[model samples]
Target chain A: MRPAAAPKAIVALSAAVAAPVHAHLVETGFGAFYDGIAHVAVTPADLIVVVALALLAGQRGTRAARYAVFALPVAWLAGGMIGARWPSAAALPLLTTLSFALAGALVALNAKVRDVGVAALAITAGVLHGLVNGATMAPAGAGALALGGAVSAIFFLTAILSAEVTALPVGWPRIVVRVAGSWIAATGLLMLGWLARSAP
Target chain B: MKTQMKRWKQYAALGAAMLVLAPATALAHREAGQAAGFLSGLAHPVSGLDHVVAMIAVGLWGAVLGPPAIWVLPVAFPVVMALGGLMGLLGFPLPGVEIGIAVSAIVLGAMVLAQLRPPLWVAAALVAFFAIFHGHAHGRELPEGTSALLYSLGFVIATGLLHLVGILLGEAHRWSAGRQTVRAAGGGVALAGLFFLWRAVA
Candidate 1:
């Protein structure tokens, strides 16, 4: 058992290092690079929430729950693509609405689950979303990419934390997801309002 | 015991009938350029307190009506709504549609809570009427082509799911509390509609 486990640890370490390189694939310009750094500096609270979701995602295996687990990353990927394409203030609400609605749909679809695989996928997807966003924030060129890599790692850890907390289902988990969803909707609304003003 | 069970059955049937019979009412208008997916998935219920309440109320009523109502009422809503949406997209008018949508919530909520028992066709007719407004709002605001279809699909799916959720909640509180909670929610929705009306007209 010890001999077998040793290689597992080594492999895990190797894969972990490789993950960051693959994660921070987005390129940034000089203008937005500083803004990314500023956002990182100012928003410690966002980081905390990301961490919490990750921990919660670590637990649970219900189909809707699992889809919700993946929602953020899916939103992130989609958002990044949209953001890349538009790169204008006017596009933010559209992106936000698109992201959140997608998340809600994924969460609503109650599917049957097999086992741990669901949990694992949910955790991966959740972290991927945070990392992708964080990467986008990094400074232009090499600096931006490097900072994004670091943020992605932090995001991954946070996802683990979210999954961990979510594991402990005290009686009802669906209700929790609904409650969480309500909050997500509220946040989306606020973002929508801000985007509307900013664009006009 | 059989008589008591039958009485309970009758009450259940009445509850179900009211949802189907709710007078035509509508709520929450969709905007032009809105995505079909977003309109159907998110906006339908979220746009107004009344829509949220009535949609769920319809579902709960169906559950009380029995298994057939469970599927039938929800199915009826989307199908009717789609037709209405098409009319709107085609530039056909649903007069006083906004008001109708709001009233749908107010009247349906009261009916369900008050346990009003109308004849079956009357109930179906009312729901069908309101569904037009709901569907028109959906179709009127849609973009051209695939997006519109997707948006309509989203709303229909969301509406169906809302009904399912209402049923589950109603089942959960099989006792009086769940039913009452729904009733209270209905009242609140009506009150909010009054506020919305004031805002719209004033």
Candidate 2:
């Protein structure tokens, strides 16, 4: 009876130690939220689109800026919800690439777009981006991911908006912004080619 | 108090020893089998300093050349590289392949440092020539029993992405200070190339 009791105690102690290790392997709650933020930060294609869109909105002035700050996040969340429900959309990457290309080109041209047009672009960009994000995010972490993504998007937009309003320099600095637009466009085009080549 | 200090010193020494031994113990077990397939191929170019620097130099040179060169060099490289890869797969000998790769970094980095704008064709040819060595190295490393097509796709995409990063950095040439910055980066690449060259020879 004593020997059997000792074995049982050892087994219980081992189980207690292993439980936390297993929990660490499967991230939940705030860990998942941080994962979502990291996911967006690491994706170059996603980052280029966000920066280009924000820059374009800012270039179109305060009204467009105001519309983008509000519209993009709301539309992104809506799109994420749609994607979570139906995850099999094969066209999201291509659509995302195309939208990014168009946005970059528009920015490079410094096109004068209306506030309504900016809002429309914002919605399209947000939805496409959120769809991709949602498709990749694990089901168990969907809520956390959405929260993190929304927070990141807001942070990025606010930063870009501030730069556009206050810090963007004149002459060469302005040209640098345009050049960045071109680079973004080039990246999009390259990715498009890559996808086409890799397509089964 | 003296005894406590001695005890703390002993603990510190033990902790330092553990820190030194930690990395060796962690890396003691290498998985026995070769990693095969697309993921392995994708990882190959990134794993080698020689491959990464040369590929990036190609993009930097292209961006320095501007316009058609920017587009043309990148396009020409993989096509020519595929030919080299074929040679490698066929077991055709290319001697000093590692040396050639290191030299590519040197020459290409020098070109960037000097802001040399060779004719578009010349630039394309230079990149294509170096690409062969890089591609052959990759092709030779294709793991046994892996799908060649998938492996080729993986390396090509990885190589292209590296070129894109270089191009983005090269775009710094749009500003005056940016031009200086890019040249400074070129100098750094050249120094790195020299180091790799030294290692290859030694």
Candidate 3:
């Protein structure tokens, strides 16, 4: 079916976005700490998402999903240009939130959600995850691409893995996704609290 | 099997081609206000950790947001941001500009974590204000005697690509097991914003 095409498209996109990102991340003056976190923690997760999405959607969804995934990096470029030229407070955050939330929503809508409650939870968790990552970029050179690429890779991989198990028993899929969402939500809460306390 | 391998080779070639063309166009710089020069303006975002993280993150988030949001939000950012940059170059003083930019990181992070649903105008206003600081940076840093068109083009293209990174990452949350990991990563970014806030004031 059409859903099967998602994963393939994501993989293709990953390949396209990764090259420049890699060069940019490697160029960071901050040394290897941020790079290591991005590459190890973030990138693998992104790649896994692609694999899961591909598995779930199979061959049919590839074209659409591929383009969908490919569009992320392109949007990154455009956003950078905006910030470079304008650099306003309100516009920056607004664009940042909308962009990340929309992408997460797209993936959720395309895939099957066994329960509406769980789906909402998953979506909310996804937004939290995306927001935090968006708030902390390297700012200069091609570093944005590099950092963004690392995070993108993580989500792509996750999509791939989710897609892989699409055919598993329905209950099983929901349970797995729910559990993951719970952990993510908890982490977000922790970060939120920490940030609030730390802020003056 | 032979056919599969052949297809793989073709894909590989395409990938290679994309890689070659990627660097020049694929990279993004910070919106450094209305700098008078080329390299300095371009170098603004790269100079500070705060601007770099939030700018790229905005692009990445746009990528995650899906098609219309991705396209509209990213498009709106640069267009508006450029306006903000113009204001800065003209010596329009925005009070608490630095603090506001830092606050944008905090607020944006909370919005993502909270999944707040605000009106479209709200989003526009938030981005518009933040763009001023970013634009100012560019204006202050841009090299003198550079073609404004070329400099703008260079930065705009780079900025869009940054949003693409966020979109892809946000989309990654769809995977089964990886959802938590992605969320955790987002949380990490928010935490980093806290660090930047401290740095800005210190």
Candidate 4:
């Protein structure tokens, strides 16, 4: 190629192959943090688990609710770090659905599980879904910063939902929580049917 | 002036009742993508006369039954309906889904009209039984290639809202005049259900 055309060719190639450069870059056109927040907002599967766990913990009482607030985001961050490094979440959706479904069922039943049980559930759901989120964001080079944003979002969502549910009066209000749980479980079951029907 | 205001109030109430009674294709829409699926799902449960009446009957009957039954029936309906939806999704083939749905309207509406207080367990069982038919029909009728999750969410939310409407209407049972009004509504629902049943059979 002629020397005059070589610069143009290089510039064109750079544009075509431009990576979401993170090294020495504080922010791209849209920041990674916002990207992470938006990701969780749109993902219903994760939201359901977060909601189910919050409702379950709150139903269990103040102690369980408090434990869940801490366990959920911490476990999610830890799991996310590992998943970002590994970056494979291809087969996670099925397990994710089942996790939320079971959590919802437990909430609906108003199970008399101990505080530890709620903590365990929170941790399990946090790690499982966080792994998927991490795997998704890592490929876009969001890494720890994006994961931190997501963890914050999860933290807030779990905190508010559990706290509100904890404060609710018993009887009719409590019954409303169970009704929400039933709806969540029903959605999961329907999704399961869809997944099973469409699986290749 | 007072008489004119009273007449206007009556006209407005009548207009509202007519709007509610009209099942202007509450369920049917074919649109692509997730948002569309949500809208479509939201409309699904209210689309048909048969579904709307039966769902309202569930709530109305619950109101008649009172207390735990009020919450229990509504809670159980979605779960059971989704089970039926699953069956439809998997091609499990429950026979007479349409007939069952029509019958649900007929029977549940009749129960509301009579204000019959059966045992709680029996009430729950009947509600659950009817829910299966509703769910199966919904599942089978789900639009192909739409976002299943959004659609399901919207559909469930709509169904719950309809039950809420019934429950609200049932709240009329608190007073003597209100009780008569509620009973009258139930009778109207039963008549609608009968029409639907005839249509289904024919």
Interface RMSD of each: 26.7, 12.3, 21.1, 19.6
Is model 3 an incorrect, acceptable, medium or high docking prediction?
A: incorrect
Q: Which DockQ value does candidate 2 get?
A: 0.04
Whole-model Cα lDDT of every candidate shown, in order? 0.49, 0.67, 0.45, 0.82
Please give the ranking of all candidate structures by TM-score, highest first, separated by commas: 4, 2, 1, 3
What tens digits encode model 2's per-residue C-alpha lDDT throughout A61-176? 77787788777777776777776667676247678877877887677667888989988998998888777666555343456454465546555664566357435665545555
Best model number under DockQ: 4
Separate DockQ for every predicted complex? 0.01, 0.04, 0.03, 0.20
Candidate 3, B64-124: lDDT as tens digits: 4444454445555654555555555555677766776676666555554544446656665
Point out where model 2 deviates above 4 Å. A1-29, A144-155, A158-167, B1-202
Error of 3 at A79 (Å): 36
For model 1 the local lDDT of residue A103 reads 36
- Of the two candidates 2 and 4, the one with more favorable lDDT, higher being better, is 4
> Residue by residue across A47-154, what tens digits does model 3's lDDT show?
222332233232124343343344333333344344434434212332332332233333333345323332333333333333323333433333454445544554
Supply the TM-score of chain A against the true chain A for every candidate structure. Answer: 0.41, 0.76, 0.41, 0.83
Better of 2 and 3 by DockQ: 2
The local lDDT score (0 to 100) that residue B164 gets in candidate 2 is 76
Pick the winner on DockQ between candidates 3 and 4: 4
- What is the overall TM-score of model 3 with all chains considered together? 0.39
Computed on C-alpha atoms, the DockQ of candidate 1 is 0.01
